[model samples]
Target chain A: MSSRRAPRVHGLMTRGYADDLRLFGSGKAKLGLLALVLAYLMLPFFLTSDFWLSVLDYAGIAAIGALGLNLLTGYTGQVSLGHAFFIGLGAYAAAQLGGPDALNLPLPLWLLGAAVFGALVGALIGPFALRLRGNYLAIVTLGLIFLGEHLFRNLKDVTGGNSGTNVDTTATLGGLDFKDLALLGENFSFNQGYFWLIWGLVGLVALLVKNLVRTRPGRALQAVRDRDVAAEVVGVQLGRYKVGAFAVSSGLAALAGALLGSYQQFVSPDEFSLFLSIQYIAIIIVGGVGTVFGSIVGALVLGGLPGLIDKYSASIPGVSTGSGDSGFISVFSLNQAIFGLLIVLFLVFEPRGLAAVWLRVKAYFKAWPFSY
Target chain B: MSEFLQLCFNGTALGARYALVALGFVIIYRATGVINFAQGGLLALGAYLAYALNDTAALPFALAVIGAVIASGLIGAATERVVLRRMVGQPVFAVVMVTIGMLFILEQTITSIWGFEALNLGDPWGVQIVRAGDVVLAQRDLWTVGIAGAVLAAFFAFFRFSKLGVAMRATAFDQEAALAQGISARRVFAVSWGISGALACLAGVTLAAGPAALSPGIGAVALIAFPAMIVGGLDSPVGAVLGGLIIGITQALTTGYQEDLFGWAGANFAAVMPYVVMVLILLVRPYGLFGTREVRRI
Candidate 1:
């Protein structure tokens, strides 16, 4: 039996050709990976309860947001600390349009309004912001977060001020009401009601991102990220791509925010703080940059960690969960500490992230006989 | 007319604080070719240390300030030796990101140590008001302006005439050449961080005595220094001061005159004004008012 396995293992290392097992360098491997991902996503519906399904829903929303950031920061090499501002803009636009006393626009138009408005605001700000580089860029964008919050707070008619705006579940896609669990099954709640919608959006965004990377515009973005001066010399319009990336990133972030707002039946300024923006960046950093699969993996790891902590908080002696505050807060602050440490650690030691580590492990198993 | 002069006076006072902070920024940028995002956090730490030392240890205010500055200088030196020194010769983006991560670490540390309360920091000099016709000026504000002026004069002399300062400037110009000439780039790096650290402490002290109480959020004022650097020129020391003055007065005038005209919220606009100016300057003159343009070879 051992001798029978040797040639198979040797074939993995020799591959008969260099490109056969080169990891993401072949279409066969890519298709195999896609099938595996489909199984992983669908497995939850069969194996998990509603609570776990809800966790996956939140992960889907985060993965969408992280995918946007990865496009801008990973593919284009631009840093932004104002991501949550765009998300807030999208969420509030939808809420205001569909609120009880809002202009009471149709649901489809309202969602479109959120994305278009976010892109416009992004373009307007990008001209000014795209000039800054390095930490200066980060600082300027961070300032925008504060400015956005202040603007929202001061504009009472639009944002409802600090008290925040709430929706009564009236906004939905056609007759598919978000709160109507009956549409799904007798056993399903609204959280489970959102399971399919969030994943469908994730799948759509992932496909869109994957296709974008293969287009000419995507090639130009990658070129600029690799070397701006060289890209400019090759007839790539640096300014256009810089602004375009921000617009796309902001529009996607808004899309996620809209989904979140509709799912929760509420949208508030506090929900879209700088912390959320940072968390999104952290998600992408842990995820493989510029890869769709990385976004999903990163979102699951970072998003699920806190939920795990909340569930197990009571089991850990001397770890006060701070019950008066949301069980989420006490655990999440610890998560922030861990996340910050992870970024530093990843940058210094394993900058390629968990995806890179997983690839290494897979390679070792495939090439077991030779171990070369 | 008097109210106008007083607005200018208050503007200059705020400008002086901005200049001190921007000077720290310029020093590090010129020497290390990296913007120290942690400067604001360092300033806040310095201010908090002074407050803590005076309140907790029951030390005299003057002695506490001295101790605080010393602590800040040590922090700066340690950061250079450990964090920044390791990052030497790395790509600009990587180094910049490290500094940002440093900012996150420092912000959390400050929050952990001080909690979130804003504290009223009293002036070293007793509070007194002087009237100039229709306007009023605080004695502490005058002190801030005077001290800032003195610090500027001293910095000029140190950089122009002193030996170590000349060596620092030489290292800033060409680090490898300076190293070839037997001037220790490491020492130059240390001295730059030390001086910058001291300036941050000075700015923190004076700012603590301003209109608002000292809080961790005061680091937001770093935005003012950022635009001032761009306006003054990144490489020019004198430009930093001039830029600070211009930015300060422009913000004051806008708040004073443009508020009613534009139906804008004055204070919020004041916060954003520097960034708006920074964007304009960056577009029109990338080298800024006093900065030297560089050739990119790719």
Candidate 2:
């Protein structure tokens, strides 16, 4: 029996609880990680510039939306080309619920309404089209983006048509004005208030998603993704798991949309176009699929890269940041071209994404000083 | 009675164009098992090629058509040899994504050359519409349907009778067997691409003649060809033609009737109607109207 226990695995394995903590399963490591997170959370307060704050706000919104898509595509092996449809649906629901006259409902209720609407709409779209497998599902979802756009453009009364709705900013909760773009206006400004609100929501959502991934439902989703037939054989219901994943993803996407609408104080069809959906998918792929941290990292890279390019290119010699007809227009359009190239290059060379690279670097450092 | 005949005429004409485009998709898919999302981009290339030859190069219409067809054929073959050949054994998903990326590259190239503007290409045969009581029809539309049907028939004859066509078919059916029998599968792939490109050129010419204008958006209509291919049955060429015809006619009728009823004031429904039908049809018959079902052993 002692011979059989002789180091079958090479990792720092131990039987005792304290030994386990010193090796792979360490509470100290987790506490250290939590401390690092706290520092990160505090770092933003030191720099509250309007421009940077606004950028962070948009990045938060994008991360929320991309996280939802990661849940669907990353965990469930489903492809969705119409994710923006759900986002737009949520935005519209938020707008409608808040009402033109501020119908006396709480802000949280309105947000919850948006999420419920998203889940319902997602469930409706899911089972109807997800019955088929492979590229068929992709096409169906892609068509929905078009359909959703057309509906938003044509339904003048409900969706406010192509121009979209200007959501009223009168909703409130517990004597705190919800529509006050600057919650911290006493010290900072409007942009920072929006930034903090978005960041707070992102943190809460991330924690919820982390916990969800460890639960039975999340494991079931992974099983379905890896092998549907095997998962089914093991008593995991395919339709239910897939539909549940869609609902949760859609709900989160809707939350992002609602927040986006609140921040912009407006909602429009163009915000949820096919290009936006493609942008969300590209961010996840570039960030690394199925990773929580990947969503945040991907959002920052996708959102910030173009701005940085334009900012630097304006001063560079021979670089056309402004050429009357040939100069970089807004960094946004240039980013589209770059985005396409990035996806191709990343898929070809770095399929494991930035998170994987980060992991490898950390492991390298940890394994250093031994010189083995 | 004249209205019904006119509807049939219009349906056949529109369907013929879609068939030509869908047929192009089917050829590439049959040979390589890749869903070439770049079909629309290639269609635009064909159209632009013809336009450049006629307007810029100062060639006769007939000569320009031939030049465009040959140029597109070479382009097709080059693409397969260069980009697609590198992705030979990759998963189907990756290959599909590569084609999607190729779409962006093709679009950028065309835009860089042509500028993003709609250009008119004059009719091939100096044609005019023949109007009857309560109905009118263009000679070009008739020519389009006739030419499309003739091309389909010619391709069928080629595959069934010609030695080269048989060789291509053999390669398509089983590359290993074709190689064992001394037929070069790569050469067959090039041939299929060439034929597919020629078909795209024909469709492009017909489309340019219709509105007498071309735009980047024109290539987008090629997306309709995918649904048409699936609706017709991916494995069957004849089904592609029939499927395209059905989709085109249904869309035309829907737009025509909607205009009569609601005065929507646009042809947008005509554009989206085929996709709607495609989704509905896919719901009932995922393999498509004439598509084959594959058996997988786990």
Candidate 3:
């Protein structure tokens, strides 16, 4: 018995740098990826209801934005409340560039245009991070949201002023419009088409971010986040990494906004406010900070919560659906209150957020038969 | 020129209100190192509580104001004890976000309790005006300036002479050193929150006293005051007052002259002028006019 060799765990062992950088680190992870792909391909057909389909579409959009935010705030330790501004910028960019009277570009060009514009603006703002730290940086970004709103409101030619502008941007690429698709001789609805388009992008963006985070710049960002002075002492260029992170994060956010505008077909100045910024912050905080998968999880949960609440508001005891309803709290107020409570409770009780909970459960199963 | 003087008078009155809010921010920030975003909620709560006491409870206006101020102070202290105490050692981002969460909860709570309709504050100085050398000022505005000046004087005196205040300042300067010297850091934190709450109450009362009327949106004034706090330097009380005055004057002047000077900029540009000014100022002095620059070490 003593001479018998221990049973080897094949997929669990990481014996080299190549193994360490593998996207699917273990058998379980590979299986999870396969399951996710299956769900992506098949879930639209299974969930044919318009309500659930739209909800998932919105969640996919939020996931894209949240991934961008997680890159900057979570991995780079930069606190920003101006995400709504960038989102709005992207939406308006789509409106102008993809609209009939303007540049009249197609889906990919407009989305890329919005990202470039967002990156330029982000680069302009990134220098402020060099000069300020902590709370000051946060408040300055808050100011950016207000300024963006003001610009959106007054720029009548571009944003159509207070009444808002219609985003007639098409999601067509290479003779295949996402608004209508025929697969296997079965026609699909707009929501289903968007479900495929948005989630497909979500997968692509996630892969891109995951790859980015595993590389050298990602390590430099984490080093700066842990301690900027120490990072600089260790030969990391603080300005380049800080500014680059902002550019990349804002670019992703703008891409998400372009998708949202195209999907919703409407963009309004009021849509981008302090509350919207707070919502993005809430998503990252609730999802696990510094985890790419956590952003998607958070977006799926918190992003879909408001729509779920709205759909079922009549049944909730104290939620007033209309002005004359017999309840103390309006549906909007209830939603706001829930968001506030979630932020507070999660921060106090589970600082590491839902990702940590998932990690714990996975660890528990991995060490089965005997408690570690 | 007379029109400009009138605008300046109104601006100073507005600045006084901003100064009061900024002062409250400075006190809490100096003591606990947390920028209390929930201060706006406290401000709105104080005004609404005074409204309830005066209109619902049928108390005298002055007495209701006093009662509201005290109650708000206690609420502030209770918040520090209950929620913030647990968050003492967390990162600054987490603490600030917690306060923001509290702000949302408080705002919604006020709306649920008070409803959305605007209510008269029922103060004695309701839309009354006074004239001085061809410049007219609202009675509430005059009272705001006078009261704000008195509060500033009292706070400075307290900081200079009071033993507890000295302990608070010492704690702010260096927490570990103050603790070693037997200063109760927790008490200092609580007291600072309490004082900030009272100041917020006063600012709310003055802001809601005149034609503004008490409403849920009244709390948003604290957002503009954030600019004031930043401009004066986050830690300087005097800087807050100066920053408030500067922002108020700039906003008032912009409103007065936007039609002529900035017509091309767009209508109602004055509303966002403070933010523009803040961005410009921050570009010049990241630490603000009076804040000390932090030293970094590897």
Best by DockQ: 3
lDDT values, one for every candidate: 0.75, 0.76, 0.91
Candidate 2 structure quality by residue, lDDT tens digits, B1-298: 7766677778878889999988988888788877777777788899999989989888987789889989998888888887777778754445665666666657666765676678877555445887877677787787888889899999999989999889978877888998899998888888887888888888888887756577766777777776777788776798899899998888677766767765553336666677788888988988788877654323
**Native contact fraction, candidates in order:** 0.20, 0.10, 0.77
TM-scores of the models, in the order given: 0.86, 0.86, 0.98
Strongest candidate by lDDT: 3
Model 3 off-target regions past 4 Å?
A: A1-9, A16-18
Q: Compared with the true structure, what per-residue lDDT tens digits does model 3 show for residues B1-298?
A: 9899999988999999899999999999999999999999999999999999999999999999999999999999999998888898888778988999999999999999999999999999998898888899889989999999999999999998999989988998999999999999999999999999999999999989978999999999999999999999999999999999999999999999999887988888888888899889999999889987888887
lDDT order, best first, reads: 3, 2, 1
Tens digits of per-residue lDDT for model 1, A1-372: 555554434322445543442335455567887996686556644644766776777788888888888888888888787899988988887787666677677667777777788888888877754566655566567767877877777777778777887754354676665555444354445666577667767888887887787678988999988878899999999899999988888888887777777766777778777668767876776776666778888998886666666788777653447655332224544555566666655665655667787788878877787688
Q: What digit string (tens of lDDT, one per residue) describes model 3 on residues A286-329? A: 99888998899999998888899999999999888999888999
Q: Write the per-residue lDDT of candidate 1 for residues B76-162, one digit (tens) a residue.
A: 888888778877765554565566566666666676566557886654655677876788888888888998999899998999999
Query: For candidate 3, what's the RMSD?
Result: 2.5
